[model samples]
Target: MVDSVVLVGCGNMGFAMLKGWLDAGMLQPGQVHVVEPTDALRERAATLGVNAVAGAAQLAAGLQPRVILVAVKPQVMGDVLPAYRRFAEHATFVSVAAGITVNFFEKHLGDKTAIIRTIPNTPAAIGKGMIVTFRNPHVGDSDAAFVDRLLKTSGAVASVDDESLIDAVTAVSGSGPAYVFHFIEGLTEAGVAAGLTRDIAGLLAMQTVYGAGALAAASADTPTTLREQVTSPNGTTAAALKVLMGGDRLKNLLTEAVHAAHQRAIELGKV
Candidate 1:
């Protein structure tokens, strides 16, 4: 269990993580501190009984948190990160800001600061997200495990030894949700174009996507096996599979798309 934690932002993702932590009993409300400049957001955080303040300046004097989560946007991270530098001597820092590198955190906090850079999709809001972490050498084994459990409050967590792989993680999971959403949208539109009512098409599209994901997650069989199970020679599923996998067109397109996102993530992390 975490003794004390400081959350630096409480926007959509941040707030969701905080709520998950509280709900999971990771820390007591009294043991958590939230720094949110916006009045409404701070109040929302306070509603959870945590010590919510407008800024780091308002934190109780001499209070040092054991774990500090930096959830602010990358664009504003420069302005917000310095406030927590005082805790560099003690706290283990975790960042969920996309495109921000571990080196970037070292530059802002301290070269030896124990930092973990993680990418969590928006699904984390619902406790089903995928989070991939890469920790700096300064982080101890115990603290690294602590981070893994802390993130699990929001969803599943994995780790990568090589920091550079984080860029690929960003492309595959960080930006992958939008791709799924777009597929659902396209499926719904296609249904409508095929003469299904808009309402029915939307429901079918949503439920099919949700069910498929849930089944894939719960089943031990590989997705390839699942696909084969649903497909038969000259069947409708086979026809669709042919359109999607024929000459590996869809596979090539998806590979290119992930590559594009990976490259962009790398570019965004530039110092």
Candidate 2:
């Protein structure tokens, strides 16, 4: 029963989700309202035919959106939440600002407000991202389901009842795209070192990662089985894997990286 939505802050991530919803036809432009302080950003949203305003005070009088999604930076959220507190009684408050928890929203928006905290990555701009959410107890099943439908327009959506798992989500999918991008950069450098032209090397590295990820997603076989299928004994792929996986080198490094990110997420939540 989500009839309309109010999206506060239309920066990169916010704009991406906004476009996703409109492009998917899940919600009409008239049904969406955007509040962005930046002129260029607000104009960008206006071009999409949605109502775009500079602040909450400019929002249509008597507005009661089903969900008010706050996408501003975590640092500024304290100043932003108070203006929208009036909507807490009816509208579900959804925050995409990292490290801001459900309890923080309740403290600002009232304890009775339904709040959803989510971590979404940059890939969502292209409609290919992973978004994970954790909802406060006040959120009803229908409201949760409606939010899921809205989030799905951007990418795959998953939820967890245990709010603590959100930090793990931040470490994993929320920050994972950068890891994959870095790996592509390294692979491209290696290709250039092996005597390939820089352009050719970059293209190969990018396509290989893209193709492999697509295959992994489409195939019924497990990734381990797929890797084994491509790697023959004493072959080139095997040799490469030996250097990468010897003594679990790559695995250990990734585990350490994820752990560091997880710890940082926990620390941020405390702030």
Candidate 3:
């Protein structure tokens, strides 16, 4: 029995992490096993040359995976998790299942099981994801580091000692992509209304967001400074910002939205 990585639920997010690991050469093809119940998804996983099975029962006895990544949906987690408790002895359980807390896993697995709860966004599908993780005390530094390297295949990796903060992380990064997408959609609509062709409007909206994010990542200037630099005295940009920031309308609205999402995350964890 080789040291392998067991990936559960080969959906978009799970497959993304698996692909990232393989693409980055962080894990070899044979070092991974995917337990995806869906035929279509299992077929897709096999394309990566990894061992794809319909269930854990197909795995060899005495085989122990170093990491068991649980990526199933939160609602279905209770039924899916109990099956993996056997691996708690040797595997560090890592979960990207939204709203499922580390305590929940320990309750299902064992209290001593090394558990790391993570919130990874959809951007992971394209290797631009942001993952925020909180680990239980049972997880040592080396184990946490291993999880970090595995997640970095998709994008950035960050750790939080406090598990409660994961709720805020979910609101910020986990569901954050949709907020950015909505902004892009709004910008595109504005462009279309301003007389641009549909295709041109879409291209402009997407490129602006892409370029701005890249600049923000590469530049040392603060976002506020960058905004000021773009807003000239009585310029079009300033006029737009005046409406957007005049009464802090957009800021307040976004704050409300994030808080709503955070509250919902906390509520979901209770179930």
Candidate 4:
């Protein structure tokens, strides 16, 4: 169990991670402290039996937490960080804000502070997220492991040695859920165009994506092999595949999309 943790935001992402930790028996409610400015948000965290405060100034005096996880938006991170600098030397700072780099944290905190930068998708709220982390040189192996353990309560965790790859990770898994959601919308529209009611089309589209994803995760075979298994010569599935796979149309479009997202991620980092 973690000795003590300070979650410096009680928004959707922060609240989700905090709930996961308590729900999974990874940490006791009393062991966590949440710092959220909003009254309602702070009260929400307080309902979980943890200490909730409006700001860092209200934190217990002489308190030292093992981890201080920041889930605030990147735009206000500069303003929010200075208040927590007093704890930087002793605590491991884990950030889940996109486009916020380890160097940024180091600049706000200190060069020697242990920091782990992570990008997690919105699905993390439901314990089905893909969390990718990159640690600075100041972080030790045990610190990395502890952060990983805490994050795993929300979903699967993976690490990258090169921080640059995080931009690609953001383009892929971080933004991938939205792409899948758009695809579902398109599928539903297609179903409607094919004479199905809006309600029925939505159910079919949503369930098909869900079921296919579940199957793909559970199957040992590659997606290509699984796709081949479902496709018959000149059959209905093949007809659809022909439209999708013809001249790599779908692949090209997705590549372009991911490239756009990747470049945007790089640009955001520069900001």
Candidate 5:
């Protein structure tokens, strides 16, 4: 078991992860330390009984954390990571910052340090997130398992051997929540246009999407097969799908969007 974990930032995503870990009994508050510069965030973390510090220098002398979770923004990582290098000699470093590569941590922490880069979606706050992870070659199986267990506190976890696939992962799962949200918005608007009240439209749109996603996750059949099961001869679903599936409009659009997101993730890594 990890004796101590140091969290670098306590933003929305970071705080959600911390809460999930604590609530799921994956970590104890007494064993966790958080470094959040903002007073509001620090106070928030402190309320959870975590030792919230304004900076790394505030950590007790000679303290060595078992894991240092880097949750800061990618643009600020270079400035923030060096201070944690002292812990790298003994601890595994896990970064949840989007678009930040393991190479970035390796550069700051040195070649021998174990590093894991993970991308977790927004749904982590609700304990239904999908996280994809890639570990540096320096990380052993044991260390990888430890990191995976920690992540599973928030939601499902998957590991990929190829680091390059991380960008693709970011494109699909990382940005997927936004796509789903936009779909909900579109559906709600269409329902309203179809003469339903705004509140009713929203309820129908939200529940339908939730039900569809739940069915997709629980069903044994493939999504294509499930979709076929829903469509009947010249039915309403078929009529709607005609515009969506015709010329593969939705598929092509989503492909373009994912590609754009993948490119942006690569660009963020370079920065």
Candidate 6:
């Protein structure tokens, strides 16, 4: 049972996960503790009825959390994490800070400590995020399952067997949201160019993307099949495909972008 969870940062993503757990009844306010130095963020956590402190020193005495979630910035982790060493012997450390590796946490906490690393996207703020996690071998199945259940409250959860795949996951799911956002921007611009009002264009673009994503997710058919289904011979979609699919323009561009993101993730890990 995850009786107590300590979240070290209360930023947007961290706060979203906390809200999901509370709203889903996966966690009780009294069982949650937040450590954030920022006054505004601390007050925000307090508004949720959880204990909020400026630092680990203020955590209740003799209270070892079941999970210690590190959500701080990657650069500050080196300075912020050492204070939680007392819990290293007992708690499972979970980090959502991108670019920081399991090795970093293990080194700070203890080699024997169980660490779980996750990369989650911004959509999680709306309970539609996709999160990919990797558990250190020291972590057992039960602990991993508990973490998975907790994460599911926010969105989808997938376990990665190999830690190396986490960088790829970061590139695909973590950075992928920005790509989709840019697509929406482009679509909205195209709609406006086609003589629609700006507001109407924005609405249509957003809804179209949302519907398409939902349909793709709900169907078992491959995206290629779905695209083909939409492209009747000599149809508008076919005309559009002539520009996008011609020479695999969209495919190659996306591949290049994801590869660049993956390389950046690797560099961040080293930092």
Write one digit per residue (lDDT tens) for candidate 6, span 1-271. 5479999999998899999999999999999999999999999999999999998999988897888888888889999989999998889999998888888998888899999999988898889989999989888788788888889997899988889999999999999999999999999999999999999999999999999999999999998899899989999989999999899999999999999999998887776
In candidate 3, what are the lDDT values of residues 1-271, reduced to their tens digit? 5558999999998888999999999999999999999999999999999999999888778778899999988888889988898899889999998888888999999899999999988888999999999999988888789889999999998988899999999999999999999999999999999999989999999999999999999899999999989989999998999999989989999999999999998998787
Clashing pairs in 4: none
What lDDT does the true structure give each of the candidates?
A: 0.93, 0.94, 0.92, 0.94, 0.90, 0.91
lDDT of 2 by residue, 56-110 (tens): 9999888899999999999999999999998999998899989998999999989
TM-score of each: 0.97, 0.97, 0.96, 0.97, 0.94, 0.95
User: In candidate 5, which residue ranges exceed 4 Å CA deviation?
Assistant: none
Best candidate according to lDDT: 4
Per-residue lDDT of candidate 4, residues 163-259 (tens digit)? 9999999999999999999999999999999999999999999999999988998999999999999999989999998999999999999999999
Over 165-226, each residue of candidate 5 has an lDDT whose tens digit, in order, gives 99999999999999999999999999999999999999999999999999999999999999
**Which residue runs does candidate 3 get wrong by more than 4 Å?**
1-3
User: lDDT per residue, candidate 1, 1-271, as tens digits?
Assistant: 4478999999999999999999999878999999999999999999999999999988888887888999998999989989888999889999999888888899999999999999999899999899999999999998888778889998889999998999999999999999999999999999999999999999999999999999999999999999999999999999998999999999999999999999998887785
Candidate 1 achieves a global lDDT of 0.93
Model 6 TM-score (2 dp): 0.95
Question: Residue 73 of candidate 5: its Cα lDDT?
Answer: 88
Which scores higher on TM-score, 1 or 5?
Answer: 1
Off by more than 4 A, model 6: none
Candidate 3, residue 45: how far the Cα is off, in Å: 1.1
| Model 1 CA lDDT for position 78 | 88
Clashing pairs in 1: none
